[model samples]
Target: MKTPLSPKSTSGLRGEYAGAGDDFTVEQDWQSYSPEAHDRWRRLYAAQSALAARYAAPQFLEGLAKLDSAGGIPRFDDANRVLQAETRWTLVAVPGFIPDAVFFDHLAHRRFPVTRWLREEHELDYLVEPDVFHDFFGHVPMLLDPRIADFLEMYGRAGEKAMAMGALDMLARIYWYTIEFGLVREEGGLKVFGAGIVSSAGETVYAIEDEAVLRLPFDPERVMRTAYSIDNFQQNYFVLDSLDQLIGSLVGLDFGPIYERWRHEQPLPAGQLQAGETPFKAVRLESLGERTP
Candidate 1:
């Protein structure tokens, strides 16, 4: 992968934010997409859907069915039709990434900001920055689930407050380990749920099936103190038993004191469990040597 990370932040939208002032939203420019771009969308959507059907959460697949964007690049208006009809959520067009404040505000209001561009033909296997396929294909489908929808909205709201406490790093970790690369247990087996995993072909294979990456039960405090990679497959993937439990995890967070206590601690290594946690035999990797840094 030639990327620094998947599209984690909304701030990299380049200069297109100039006109939107603080909101940073723009038209989808649905007609401006070249035939080649749409073709890229078709190919990526086909491949990812096939892979995700096997690895993605059931609700994620359901979202894709509802959105109906598998055959080609979907118009923002069209996707909104389904999103609004089902979840009362909508996709907003953006130029690549947007500022965090703007991004959170959009999410807080049930609006998902999707980038309107596609990755180049040359970088099909991997790209440095997130494209339309990653944002929409990787993420949108799962938004249909009520718990995830509500959880994300709360995340955005809490995130806005966390920023004032100078604890955005702690908050971003929650988004990273949960929203971008989270796993969930189903039928006693772990399955992929994070956007960063389902969208990437390699990760879709490596995350659940690899047996090389350690899987730990979700712990918000541990997740906040842990460091993660922005450039490669993750060494540690957190697992949540259910969406209700995930939402429950945030019920009584007093992040200020937690942040102050662990804020300056050395980041937990990506490949190792800390002192308080144990490597359950069922979730431990098959070969620790195969893990990444």
Candidate 2:
């Protein structure tokens, strides 16, 4: 859900404006996708899938297997059949980014908004905005996990509270650090579960193997108080012991007091560690030894 706090003007962005309804949803028009678009998806999937197998969490790998999206850009209707059965979630198509309120409402009800259009050929390596590949290939598999599924619904429900309290920035940080760019400690070593990392081959390896990055244990208050960068690879990534820990940290927890204290305070810089904070030890990639290709 890479949405803006307020709706940006999309007057000239015909890709995002055409056929959108009051709610900003549009028909996926699955058949209209060119063969080239499907080919692009195939290439993106093949490259990322190999990287993911070596560095992704078991839960993510399981979900990816269930998705069976290797062949082409999946029809949302077809993917929904598996998603609805697995987690009672559905994917809705939108032209591009929508307003935060609209985004929260969709998540609150277990509907995910995926962009209807694909990026052009030249933009394959990188794109500033989220496109269909980033939304579906990056995120949808994780939605198959029950913990993640329930956690997101709760996050969506909490949106109004964050907005009313003028704490949307803090909440967005939570989403950015966890859903979009989180890491987790599995039995083998540190592995990525974040969509943002798993979707990019470069980061999929960089996040774990790069000793220069800062990895810290997940802390709700610390996460909310931290700032992040969008233009490049993250300087800091939060690590979860388990998905259960992630859910337990926020379930029925009050954020009012936390927000009141930090809302007026300057956010901690992205890469700088606070005094007394310890960084998680980097995982040794060489020790992993011969992963399946």
Candidate 3:
């Protein structure tokens, strides 16, 4: 029997970020944070960490404990010691979002570009752009899982090829639905592993408990044709049988022809499911129209 999901909250907005690096990385100024800044990190961590303990994937929980992020915002070197040892991955400080090619290159090399700042005291609940907490607290933990790590590198390699094929958008959708907002079925049932959903206190609850939205089984080809918003809660989500399924889906699958076909097909709207789709779990998104903008 599937376990019912518990309630959490949905999320809001994006913002601007500042990175000190010139090309793709910046020196993480470990000593520059103020007492107030640490306090902000503490508040954010205490709340999100509590939620993560309850809702995040088991692997993420394990990684979070290994990193010891509860003290405050983590120094890149401090976390790197454990990450490099575990999965050969490292986090680099960045001002904000980098170019697509640069971002992909980082992943290909097993390096993740983390935005270097924290959200202000007032903006703790939501921010327009990903801050340090969002990047590291939300994403880096999962990088410790070996299979997910390998798949990430493969994703980066595929992304570069997709860019050349003009299927970058198609590929971005894949990243959004999988890496950022994916759900995986476990012994207990559908659990989310995506950073975007895990990081936000609200999205943490909304993604799982709210049955008003579509939670279709993952189909990469179908995902490639879907649209999304950078500033809002996802209109749709895709579920995986397991993270292993995620890696399995891409193994020996070529996108060269998939991109050609996708390029000519009209994009699917963000909030609608395609006809003939069977929901692995029947859910009703009755509150979909009542969401915060």
Specify the highest-lDDT model's number.
2
Ranking by lDDT: 2, 1, 3
- Model 2 residue 175 CA deviation in Å: 0.9
Best by TM-score: 2
Report lDDT (CA) for all predictions. Answer: 0.78, 0.87, 0.78
Off by over 4 Å in 2: 4-8, 11-14, 291-293
Q: What RMSD does each model have against the real structure?
A: 5.2, 1.7, 8.4
How well is each residue in 123-198 modelled by candidate 2, as lDDT tens digits? 8887777888988888999999999999889889889999899998999888899888999888868999998898
Clash totals in order? 2, 0, 14
Regions of candidate 1 where Cα sits further than 4 Å from its true position:
1-21, 280-293
lDDT per residue (tens digit) for residues 1-293 in model 1 = 11112333335434254454347677887888888888888999888888887778888888888888876788989888887887788998877666567777888899898877788888788865777888888878888888888888888788677778777777888988988998987665667888999999998878877655777889899899888998899998888988787789997878889888887777788879777776433332233223422
For candidate 1, the C-alpha RMSD (Å) to the true structure equals 5.2
Give the local distance difference test score of model 3.
Answer: 0.78
